[model samples]
Target: MSAPAAALDWAQGVWDWAAANWYYPDEPGRGIRPRLIEHIRLSYASIAIGLLLAVPLGLACVRWKPLYPPLLTGVNVLYAVPSIALFFLLLPYTGFSDWTAIVPLAVYTLVILLPNVVDGLHQVPDHVRQAAVAMGFGPLRRLVRVETPVALPVIIAGLRVASVATISMVSVASLVGLGGLGRLILSDGFRRQFDAPIVVGVVLVVLLAFATDALLVLAQRLLTPWARRDRPRTGSVRRRRAAATAAADAPALASTAVAPPGKG
Candidate 1:
């Protein structure tokens, strides 16, 4: 059979199992939707909190050079720490509650996002800053109107990376009873029902990542239409003509000023 037919056959089997086993009272914990939603909510919450803290912190790091080294070093160290290790480390203090998952997940986002934010801010040209200043825009005003808008694409790229990282980490969070697709994997894996949980986990992750990427693409088009649309083909043509005119005039002016090579 074809790939689609094989997928359909596998899906039909899983669906039948789910239909018979889900919420059967004897199976008490079979419904996957609630667990999936809880996982999603936790991941979203962590990422939101991470962005809230990291964006401003990132801005500050760029604004104040002294903070970048130490601050980023800390974030990097945290990122390097293994996820399972962090989970176990937190378990004693936070005891496997949502906090255990959320705190580490939020911290992980900073490692992925902060450098991108700083790079984005730094990518704003000096001429733009000077122009904004000449227009009487103060520091905060310039940052809000000029710098932030110009840096938004890069910033959003960082956010996209951070979001994917958050989702992946939250899958690890399921090991601590947080009830994500990871929980399904762990539960079914233990029962030697290998295919179902692996299939669900892989499908969930692929779908989630694709959905996020699509949303980011939509956001980029909406927020930065100039970035997506073909500008060089249209605008560059006019610019090139102007440059060619300037170049063509330069030799004529130089030749006219040569004093005919004998009038001196």
Candidate 2:
């Protein structure tokens, strides 16, 4: 049979099996929807927890420049560890629990997120920060009100990347039999039901990544209007104001020039 025909045959078989054996109320493992939801939740939870840990850690790292290289190196080393190897390493202690999935995923996020967060904070113009400091804003106030707001778009960009990475990595969670769309792919592929699993997995991943990126774009638009707005367009406004001020001074200058020296 052609590849398409073979795929259709496999899909038909899987669907038939799914129709008959799909509803496992007690186990809740048969439907793709529930498993996909588990995957998404795991991904989001890991990213959220990682962000909580990483943002402050990144901020702290900024204050301690000497520590950044070593700390980032450690996170990078941990992130580079193979997922299967990491899973096995954690198996002894976590033993296939949700914590096992969460911890590795969270650790992976540190590598991707921390550097970006630190870079984003550093990217804030020095003068902007100096101006805040000159205005007598304390370190905390400057960070909270000026630096962070300016850095938010970049920070959120890092978060968006981390979130997508977390979602992709969560597929590994199914190797430990933690339920996910990966479970569907694994089981169906083994059964030679290629099309169904591939379709479902790809669709889920694309949709999730797209939705997340769209949300981040919306957030950037909302938070960083200045990034978009403070452009050459504002130079036009500045030029117009300058012209108006010069015009207001014009008659006075003309009158003084025509009014005959310092006699008045």
Candidate 3:
């Protein structure tokens, strides 16, 4: 068959399979729709747990310079572990439950989130921080008010990457007998050598990843409007804003930095 012909056939096949299997009133829990919901839940849980873990660890690392190396190394080691192996290791304890999938996926996010959070905080120019400190902003207050807003773009970038990775990783959960779109690819497709389910599974995963990433981007724009240009452009807005903020604060920060000790 020609490429166009094959493509058309595959498209038709997908539509047909979705109609039959995407949702079935008779078999409520056993359809593509449920699997997709499972996939989304798994992805969201993973990213949430990862943020809860990583953000604090990342903050601790930035607050205390000594903690960064060891914490980063540990998460990187977790990242290095094969997802399948981790799932298997968790199987005995977590069983064929969502936790089995969520634990590993959440751990994987730290490899991205940890560094990004720390780096984003560290990326704040020394001068701006000095101005903040001089302005009577305490450590916690400064971090919340000043550093966090400045750091949001980088943190959100990491979030976007982590969200997509988590979504992709959720498919692997099917191996542990948990349901997700992966069941379509693994049990429903590969086991039966059917193309439709596999194609549907793959396409859904991609679309979910894309949708999740787009939401994170919109979040970044909202969270840090200072980083947005008069017109939107990729890769330049945050850098320009960070630089401009630093440069604009340079004169003020300079006096704070060079002030004699114990001088009021």
**Prediction-by-prediction clash tally:** 0, 0, 0
Off by over 4 Å in 1: 1-11, 18-30, 232-264
Tens digits of per-residue lDDT for model 3, 79-146? 77888889999999988888999898888877778888998999999999999999999999998889
- Per-model CA lDDT versus the true structure: 0.71, 0.72, 0.80
Q: How high is the lDDT of residue 236 in model 2?
A: 81
lDDT order of candidates, top first: 3, 2, 1
TM-score of candidate 1 on Cα atoms, chains taken together = 0.78
Candidate 1, residues 1-264, lDDT tens digits: the string is 999999999899877765554454655456666556667787788888888888888778877889999999998888878777788889999996888888888888777678877888899999988999999998888877888788877777777767766776677776777737677667665458667766666577657756765576567658875544344556677675565445433433343353122110
> After aligning candidate 2 to the native by TM-score, how far in Å is the CA of 202 from where it should be?
2.4
Q: What is the lDDT of residue 171 in candidate 1?
A: 74
RMSD of candidates 1 onward, in order: 15.2, 17.1, 10.8
lDDT of 2 by residue, 1-264 (tens): 899998889778756755654457877756777777888888888888898888888888877888789999998888767876777788899897887888888887777788877887899999998999999999888877888788776677677767767777777677788736667766665457565665666567668867875676666666776655333545688785565445433433443344222110
True lDDT of residue 10, candidate 2: 79
Candidate 3, position 167, lDDT: 85
Candidate 3: how many backbone clashes?
0
